[model samples]
Target: MTPELLRARIKGGEPLMDLDLRQLVLTPGDYAGAVFMRCDLRGVNLAGVDLRDSQFIRCQLQDTIWDGAQLDQCVFHGSNASGARMRAASIKEMNWSDSQAIGMDMSEAQWVSVNFVKTDMTDVCLKGASLKQVSFTECAWGKADMSGTRQEQVLYMYGDLTQALLQDAHWDGVVCVESDLSGQDFHGQTLQRCQLTECRLEGCNFQDALLEQTNFKGAFMRGAKLINARASRAMFVYADLQEAHCQGGRYTQSLWADACLDHADLSGADLTQSILHRTRCNGASFMNAELEYADFSYADVSRADFRGSRFMRTQFHRALIAGTRWGNKAGVLEKDPLLFEAEQWSAGRPTAPRAGY
Candidate 1:
């Protein structure tokens, strides 16, 4: 059908079905309340168009351009939008389920209350976009670019965002549960109140990042780089951080209960007020680190290095200190006067100075 006829049909509240509108330029048109079923709109240019309340089912939108268009309350199911460009579009209350949007460009777009379910948006570019109340369920966004994007109340569940770019993105109240974010780079980013529980963050780079109240419970962050990062009040319960590099990082008031940090390098890290209860830090290095007010109760610190580390009020009660090196000295806890005194005090034994006669 011609574009004029399509517009007239849409104006008359008629649904356009089984139409082959491929390679058509429908710029500056209004297709509100349109219902497109099994339509082929490949390589079509719908720039500056209004497609509100539209329903696209099993449509072919490959290489289509919807730049600067309004797609509010739109539903796109089982559509293939590979290589499509929708830059600077206003997409609110949109539902895009079972869609393949590979290599799509949605840069600088505004998305509000958008739900993407079972969608494959691999290598999609959403740079500098504004996303609020957006939810992605069972989606695959591998290598997608979300740099400089602003997100609020965003949730990603059972999805794969592996190798995705999130540099300089401002995130608030963002939760990514049971997602695979492996090898993703979050260097120098500031994440506040974010939860990445049960996520696969193996080998991910969080160097120099500032994370406040961020939770990584049950996460597999082995070999991850957190050098010089500030992770205050963060939770890493049951996390596997083996061989991870956290040198010079400030993990104050953080919780690592029941977590594994074997062979992890935490040298020069400020772990003051942090809890390592039942955590395994075997062969880990804490040289020159500030462990003041840090708790290591029941933790396995065997063969760990604590040279030059400040231990004011640091608790090692019931902790395994076998073969541990403490400030240029290597021996059992019985030989170390400082450790022995702390242990004695922890056991309710009086170690105070004797009163003068």
Candidate 2:
């Protein structure tokens, strides 16, 4: 009955604004270009409707199900869409910015060129969705379920991905910039070919993960764990890895140029052909590690430990080695006579540091 009025409104070119249409069931309607502004559409089931190019401005769309509907080019501006379900919908080119979309379900939906800026999407379920070129800028994704999603060219700039589920998802060319993903667990997950540039990854775990060719340039990964991970040719250029633990990791041919690895533990790791030019390795440990053909030119290796490490053909040109513990390390550094300095300080050197890592 109300859909007939909606059809009449569409036919008369009258905009639907400030109406309490909670009982509106938009079933089988070609109400294209329908404009719903500030309407109370809480109980409206917009299923199987052709609502293409519709505008929903500040609508009360709580618990509204638009499953299997065609809502292409829809604009949902400043709306409160809590618990709304749009499952398996063809929602292409949708703009859902500045909206409170918490707990909204968009599972199995085909979202192309979608943009969700400054939205609070906490606990939103996008599982099994096909998202291409979707950008979520400055959005809060706390506990959002994104497992089994097939995303490509997706951008997550300045977003908070705290406690987001990303298991078994196939990601291609996804870029996450300046996002706060601190204390997240990505253990044994494969994030290959992804870019996490300048993101905060403090205490995040990437244990045994495949990170080949992934770029973490300028990332702040303090106290992060990458144990036994295979990250060949990965880029950590200008990254801050202070107090990070990468023990037993395979980092062959990886670049760590100008990186801060202060107090980091890379013990028993394979760093063959890896370059650490101008890196700061103060108080770091590479004990029993493989450093074959690795380059550490102009690096500050002061007070660092490389005991029992294999250093065949390793280059350390002009590297500071004051207070460095090299226990029978098989390598000859062509150091300048002036570069060799003496350890001038140390009161009571205990078996470990005061801050027991």
Candidate 3:
């Protein structure tokens, strides 16, 4: 279909369906409010065109170019736009559900309140894009490059973001629940109040990042690097951090209940007022760490190093300290037999005989 014909049909309120518009160089025209059903638009270039409020249902848009196009309020349901390029497009309030957008280039695009539900956007380039209130539900975003992207209130639920490049991305209030973000690099990024619950973040690098008040509950962060990260008030309940390097990180008031930190290095970390109830910190190093007012009740610290650590007002009640090293001492709890006593003393164990013996 030629650009003039397409414009004339749209202006005439006629739907363009079942047409083969392959390799068509659509001129810069206003094709807003057009309905394109079952159309073959493969390799078509719609650069600098105005396609606002357009509906593309079950269309084949393979390798199509939409660079710098206006796609506000557009809906693309069940359409295949694989390898399509929409770079620097103004895409607002766009709904693209159940579409195949694999390898699509949307770099530097301005997206607001856009939804991409159940779409295959794998390896899509969204670098330097500005996204506000954007949601990507159940989408396959594996290896997608979102580096340097600025996002606000972005919801990424149940998406496969494995090996995705998000380095230097500025996130604010971003919630990524149940997403597979394993092995992704977020090094030195500032993620304030971000919720990444139940996500797979194993082998990911978060070194020197500011993750204040971030919720990572039930996340698989094994072997993840968090060295020098500022993660105050963060939650990691039931999460796995085994063998993870967290040396010199500030984790004040963080919760690690039932989490696994076995063989993890936490040397010089400030864990004051943090909770570690029932957590496994076996063979973990806490040398010179500030553990004042921290709770480790019922936690297993077997063979863990606490030498030169400050533990004032720290709770270690019912914790297993076998082979654990303290400053200038090792396994020397013989002097304090009452150290094994529970916080609540058992009844019927009279200290100075019954009052009415």
Candidate 4:
């Protein structure tokens, strides 16, 4: 059934079945409480219309326009709506599961209590939108624009958000477990109590972002850029952050226990009162980085590079340090009693220091 046929049927009180309304134009129309399952409404113009409580199951609505439309309690399951326009629309309690909606624009829209489970929303634009209680499970949002979007209780569990733009986006209680967010742009974004466990965050830029109490456990963050990021009491336990760039980032009482940070760059980073127990930092660079009262107990510093790094009371207990560079820093190398006894400095021996003193 086509759109005209469906409209005629609605006028004549008839039922629609398996309608193929591809490229239909229904602009400024009232389609409230309509049931349109398995329809092909591609390239349709549904602008400024009322589509409340409508059902669009398994529909192909690619390149469709629904700008300034009202879609309350609507269901769009398994739909392919790529290149669609839904700007400034009111979408409350909508279901869009397992759908592909790439490159769609929904700027300044109001999305409340919407469920977008397992959807591929790559390159979609939702800038300056109002999202409340929105749930997204196992979705791919790579290169998506979420700048200046305001959201609360948004769920993004196991989602791949690599290279997505989230600049100046404000999120509250966002859950992102096992997601790959490598090389994503998160400049000036504010996260409150966000959880990012087991995610791949290599080369991610978080410049001047506010990450209060963020949880980043077991994440692989090699060469990530977090310059000027404000993190207070952030937890990064068991994380593999080899060669990460954390320049000028602020950390107060941060926890990085058992982290593998080999060859990581922390130039000019403020790690005051931080705790790093049992960390493996072989070949890590901390040039001009603040280490005031930071604990490094039971850490493996073998082949690590801490040249030109500031250290005050930075403990190094039982740390292996073969060929490690410690440039002009006064610190104690506490040896464990259970390890082998320290040998004396013998002249003309293989294990002797140079006689340049």
The lDDT per prediction is: 0.89, 0.88, 0.90, 0.80
Instruction: Count clashing residue pairs per candidate.
Output: 0, 0, 0, 2
Query: Lowest summed lDDT over 10 consecutive residues: which window, candidate 2?
Result: 340-349
Sort by TM-score, top down from the best: 2, 3, 1, 4
Per-prediction TM-score, please?
A: 0.86, 0.87, 0.87, 0.78
After superposing candidate 1 on the true structure, give the runs of residues whose Cα lies further than 4 Å from its correct spot. 2-8, 23-29, 328-357
Model 4 misplaced regions, further than 4 Å:
1-15, 20-31, 140-143, 303-314, 321-357
Which lDDT tens digits does candidate 2 get at residues 1-357? 477878888767788889898876665968888888999989578888888888899989998888987888999999998999999887789899899889999999888899999999999999999999999999988899998888888999998887898877766778999998888777887788889999999999999888888899999999999999889999999999999999999999999999999999999999999999999999999999999989888999999999989988788878999999998856746453434442212333445657857
Residue pairs with colliding backbones in model 3 are: none
Output the worst ten-in-a-row residue range by lDDT, candidate 3.
Answer: 328-337
Full-model lDDT, candidate 1:
0.89
Residue 55, model 4, lDDT? 75
Clashes of 4: 2
List where candidate 3 sits over 4 angstroms from the true fold.
Answer: 1-5, 23-29, 328-357
Error of 3 at 5 (Å): 4.5
lDDT accuracy of residue 194 in candidate 2: 83
Q: Candidates ranked by lDDT, best first?
A: 3, 1, 2, 4
- Please estimate how well model 4 matches the true structure, expressed as its whole-model Cα lDDT: 0.80
